[model samples]
Target: MIMRQAWLSSQVLSRVEPNGQAASVWRFFAGALFPIQLGSRGVRRIKNIAYGPEGRKHLLDIYLPKGPATAPMPVLLHVHGGGWIVGSKHQQAQPLIQYMASQGWLVIDINYRLAPWNRMPVMIQDVIRAVAWTKANITSYNGDPDFVALTGGSAGGHLVALAALASNVDGLRPELGDADCTVDACIPVYGLYDLLDQNQAMEVGVGEIRSFMTRFVMPKSYSEDAALWEKISPINHISPSAPPMLILHGQHDSLADLESAKAFAESLSRISKNKVTFVDLPGQQHAYDCAYSPPAPEHARAVHRFLESVRKDKQR
Candidate 1:
């Protein structure tokens, strides 16, 4: 009996129940049960760090493992997805951030400005700003700034890819010397790649994503600007210098097509001649990894495997 925080309104509940207290029966759960051991460790450092120029206070929740200062640990910056319209770093992301850090990676969960109030490049800029923030301060948290990687799901995934590709974009302005800021790799889960494709996909009832798209760009319509779409879309910006990319998608994903990941991986292969792994988890859907207890949950397991490989590669 969990009411959906996003949609819960006593006014709407009035129709079903004369008494407001009855609304609690329909409570919405963010995901399944989150296992404590696979989640946050009390032994970690929790930092409410800030970054971004103009003294903009973009807060980051950092989880640093208890370890020696002599070593540099890899970092994963996680962006939460609420279709870019609604969500926070504290909720949907806590489970994964906790889990990844428990596996020995320093995890940084960042919050960016949402849509309607902000749009397009701004969202991407926010993520870059967070990465910059991490580069400058992660060492204090026992994290190797040079070994940072990107990971997120859905809109979060889009931002993850965007941050990696836009590293050279003039505006982000990282305080850390540029060397520590570049991403070593990326792991995007069920990401939306093409706006035009997403728009078309929505027409087929998959368009629930329009809420997030419209949120990122508040112009009332995407039809007005063709270049803006191309400028913000991550799929078009692939380069030979791009880092290794591992994209995971559900074969049954209705919101974003698995084909988008395939296309991105193909582009990465053609441009960078680097490793680009695309995994299509059978019988899964978008954000399947978020499940507290997944049926098969291959998506979450795959992420652990990918991170292990990245660690091995780093050691080599």
Candidate 2:
């Protein structure tokens, strides 16, 4: 157990260092250590399946339980978060994905077009495309397409929330086929929900929000058109028909403030007819479950239980 924790720490440090030169070495060691510890957990991984035309950015990785089953397993479509600027389907959510797959679930981690290049709606479109692809083709991999759930942390949490709340919205689907992209349940961990609120809370004359918006989110600044920010925010789109949701946020999160998550949950509970469960991790920071720690496994178990409850409810 001690050795495993050491390797996990090394793995996290390798990927998080600011220095570009040392990153590769840490990544090498992290990569080498992970499989030895996890060993796919009796699951088979299918890599680099294309979901869109964005070349590498549109690709996703799938983890399927080994051997045959009497029935198709529930699917978890995971979106990664990098503040909409940078992030990959790989590396993030390793513990959650592996543990879920080990417990007889089909887990898919996806990548989408980044900002300053892809922009708003495009990132969401890529996610919709990935969902469409999964619904259409996952049966071949022994996954039950109809029982798909969405999960991600940070920016990923935001995207999944938007995808769930705005499911099948014509403006978002656009060129994508007429497939039902609705998920059975959604889990958004430490996600940013209200962009406009975030902008309003920013200190006067601070260009951080403006800089991020201009470069990654949209060409028009939030100040130029504040209403547009609300239009794109997931919190503003919630409805009674939206799927059941599980929100996980750390009390100590620096990014994606906890109060925002609480407010969002309150709104959802008041408005939505479905169940909304919020778990507040004490003393936990952003992306707390990403690393190997006591909290990581405990959160994973919470996720498993939540997913199972949703699945059972759907079965009835």
Best by lDDT: 2
Which pairs of residues clash in candidate 1, taking residues 3 or more apart in a chain or in different chains? 2-27, 2-28, 3-27, 3-28, 115-215, 119-216, 202-207
Candidate 1, position 165, lDDT? 75
User: Model 1: per-residue lDDT, tens digit, 210-283?
Assistant: 55465455454456666666666776667887777878776677877777566766666788755677766556
In terms of lDDT, the poorest run of 10 residues in model 2 is 14-23
lDDT tens digits, residues 189-291, model 2? 9987876664244222235655767776875777776665666688878898888998987766777678778878888888898889876765667887676
Task: Score candidate 1 by TM-score against the native.
Answer: 0.76
TM-score of each: 0.76, 0.84
lDDT of 1: 0.64
* Model 2 / residue 37 / CA error / Å: 4.1
Candidate 2 accuracy as TM-score: 0.84
lDDT value, residue 256 of candidate 2 = 69
What candidate 1 gets wrong by more than 4 Å, as runs, is 1-38, 42-47, 53-57, 67-70, 93-95, 170-180, 198-220, 295-298
What lDDT score is found at residue 303 in candidate 2?
76
Q: How far off is residue 78 in model 2, in Å?
A: 0.4
State the weakest 10-residue window (summed lDDT) of model 1.
Answer: 1-10
